[model samples]
Target: MVLQRPAAPDFVKRVFTAEEPDLVWAGDMTEIVTEEGRLYLATVIDLFSRRLLGYPMGARHDADLVVAALNMAAATRGGDVRGGIFHSDRLNSPSTRPGSSPGPAAGWASPSPWAGSARASTTPSARRSTAY
Candidate 1:
């Protein structure tokens, strides 16, 4: 069964501000159509650099996929993710729910903005984004 948590108090409005790298991160999941089938890709990006910190793909779009991505991000940072703020769209997915995450040990506080930018900030590579 899906877990639930009380309504969260948003710490971030529309601002995606961060003082330093690893201070704040944004994550999102999207379905990608491959030749074989569909894959759910969960990615965590460091807002400061707009670099993809972690990305994990799974057949199921469930909490496990999100957790795997989060774990990878933490590992990339040497497991010192304390005081980091993870922002994402507050979809009613099992992965995005409060108290359902396994990242509290790292002291990461995930705040879901009313709306969030799933795409990374404009970068040289971002120009390749397709309109279709």
Candidate 2:
């Protein structure tokens, strides 16, 4: 039998631009293959400045890793992410997971946005410079 996953509410609606920092934030996860094993990297970025607000790597790709990244992002902004929107393709599971509270109660806006299939194209550029 095929089971259907609950639909995530759309808050972004394909609009990925943010006029100011903290107004819109996006998160994504990547898997890295290593000699020893695979590692997961979770990142949170400020859509306006295209700045990487949070990044956390771990052996497991679970809610804990996502939460750590979110906490780091919040801490990066001085623990004040009260009214900002956080969009992500893989957040629905973590957010709805039992005992997880990575939403409004954690200082972020309610009904977090989901990027779904457009995650890749909508995510901010990750280019880096050699010079500091």
Candidate 3:
């Protein structure tokens, strides 16, 4: 698919920061309706650089929409987020709440198993820690 640039492209600049570019990454899903009202686009953006990493355009939104976006980002990042943070706002959508994805956590149905936050430090991990 060919991506068209807006009339004004000179204003675009990189917004990466130490936290976002190196330590944290972000993803969020939002929908838009076309003027014809015949199409919908659910887009996922990377907050680090304001980049559109993935999007699923269709008449309606679905779980695969968000998952596909994450898949794209994962592929771009080699699916390895060791010591990195993947952050997102709370999932309040019907597709993200409880009983959604046959998973143990209601809000966490992403492909990365350790992507979610831990309630306690007791969560088992064989990796060694560095004390500050």
Candidate 4:
């Protein structure tokens, strides 16, 4: 369940009107362990385009780390998400993280139903992203 408090993009209606190309764009993270038994890998993807947007590898999960990747995607798209839907299984947690951290805000999520050069902001984790 995408834990975005803000309503889906205004273009969500358009996404549901079709099937391929301009439909759903889901994103989620996965953990990859190397021979050293280290946890790493946080990824964001464009489900419709089947493209990997941004990711970072580390020993644990943190709100800032997630923001870093999300920021990359936002910067990549120049912060233009007039109409788009961002689906993710993970919850966005910010309020639960330590102080002196990235604030809570909505991340851009694409422009229109298509995914190419658009961004998706975050509402900051309400419960601090797990540092796993």
Index of the highest-lDDT prediction: 2
Worst 10 residues of 4 by lDDT: 110-119
Write candidate 2's Cα lDDT for 19-38 as tens digits. Answer: 89888778887889999998
Report lDDT (CA) for all predictions.
Answer: 0.58, 0.60, 0.41, 0.44
- Off-target runs (Cα >4 Å) in candidate 3 are 1-17, 20-22, 35-47, 102-132
How do the residues 22-110 of candidate 1 rate in per-residue lDDT, one tens digit apiece? 77778788989999998888888988888888787888665556556666777777766656666766557655455454432223433
> What are the per-residue Cα lDDT tens digits for candidate 3 across 24-125?
445555566668775444444555666665555555444455445444544465554354444444455555553453321222333432223212112112
Clashing pairs in 3: none
lDDT-wise, the better of 1 and 2 is 2
**How many pairs in model 4 have backbone atoms within 3 A of each other, for residues 3 or more apart or on separate chains, i.e. clashes?**
20
Candidates ranked, most accurate by lDDT first: 2, 1, 4, 3
TM-score of each: 0.67, 0.69, 0.49, 0.48
Cα deviation of 68 in candidate 3 (Å)? 1.2
Candidate 4 structure quality by residue, lDDT tens digits, 49-88: 6666556566655545555455444444555433444554
- Clashes (backbone N, CA, C under 3 Å), per candidate, total 0, 0, 0, 20
